[model samples]
Target: MNARKVLLAEFLGTLLLLAIVVGSGIMGERLANGNAAIALLANAAATAGGLYVLIVLFGPISGAHFNPAVTLAMKLRGEALPASLAAMVCVQVAGAVLGVLLAHAMFDIALWQPGDHVRTGVAQWLSEGVATFGLLLTIVLGIRFRERAVPALVASYIFAAYWFTASTSFANPAVTLARSLTQTFAGIRPIDAPAFIAAQLVGAALAVLAARALLPAHSSVRR
Candidate 1:
């Protein structure tokens, strides 16, 4: 893919993802305040469903890797070029900030910070790892089984992981970092953000190895 095209795809994909995540998070928090479990589920469900559709529509254009993990895996598979990877990551992150900024225009996000502080400590770190693992696993396995159906399968897996996983499935590194920038319902504390991003990268890196060594050979996306 061309640099311009790759950048456009990344920007659009991330924008859509952030909108889905931030919007759903706000609604979930509003409805499930004092109900942490339900709130997380609601948000996770929204993210999964929204991503499923968006990835389907955009995957052909840019692989619909709204998450960095997906891009990393695709790159490792030789489906993605390093320049494109950098372009995608950069544009995606910028798009995330724009999405958040756009969201705050319509919604007073600060008022919705229900918790005195965001979730932190080992729980938060583990949540990042768990979320990233599930997300990367779904992407790798989905491609292994049905290359064309990967986008949809990823979306479905994310939706399911939302309720089943402990961390409510905040799997995207860019999303996590971007979330820290806002004080909204979807926000994570700035101090705690880097570890989560690092965890996601590590999870995705391992998934790449797994996809290479374990999955059946498929040249559809070479590595």
Candidate 2:
């Protein structure tokens, strides 16, 4: 029952997260009159706001991990049970895909179209690494010092990261994969997902190690 609860929470949280991302991107693009900056602003703001609400709603049930990278970090940090990590990632990915489909359906777009958006190069990969690193770092520190503020902290960081990062900070592997299925403003070329996922893994691992070394030994937070 407990595992079921975790899975349900994760699935729902991830679904909502991706829906916000893709839906807002489409809406923003349609409304922005070809202004990339304005479209991005709407997308980022909606994502951040929706993410915060979802986390608050689901944190008690599944720790509100809508990202596979975040789940991996928790697993490595010994916060998440090894037996549960695989299930969590699976559900998150599935939920993400479903979310994209939902968004497309709402916007009357074709489902499962591959994205053509070309997000690549060394700089973009490096930005993904940095973005994931910061995200995990914030989670770890927030859990340890200010558990109550984690939702807001994470949302705010992501909102800023969208503007600062070259690739707009798709810090979650599941999100990167799902977004590849869409041809919207939030989409990334399918070919680019692998590198982004790789960067996110590296970043998550680094954040786990850093947190282990820096945080107090007896901290209450698991990850």
Look at candidate 2 and give me any clashing residue pairs. Answer: none
Best TM-score goes to which candidate? 2
lDDT of 1 by residue, 1-223 (tens): 5667767877887987887788777777888857877877787787878887888777777767777777777777787453467777888888887777666655665423322236567776776777787678777776656777776777787777677665556788888767776776677777777777887788788777776787767556522
The whole-model lDDT of each prediction reads 0.73, 0.93
Best by lDDT: 2
Summarize candidate 2's per-residue lDDT along 1-223 as a digit string, tens digits: 3898899889999998999999999999999999999999999999999999999999988899899899888888777442388899999999999999999999999988999999999999999999999999999899898899999999999999999999998999999999999999999999989999999999999999899889888957633
Instruction: After superposing candidate 2 on the true structure, give the runs of residues whose Cα lies further than 4 Å from its correct spot.
Output: 220-223
TM-score for all models, in order of appearance: 0.86, 0.96
> Global CA lDDT of candidate 1, please?
0.73
User: What lDDT is reached at residue 16 by model 2?
Assistant: 88
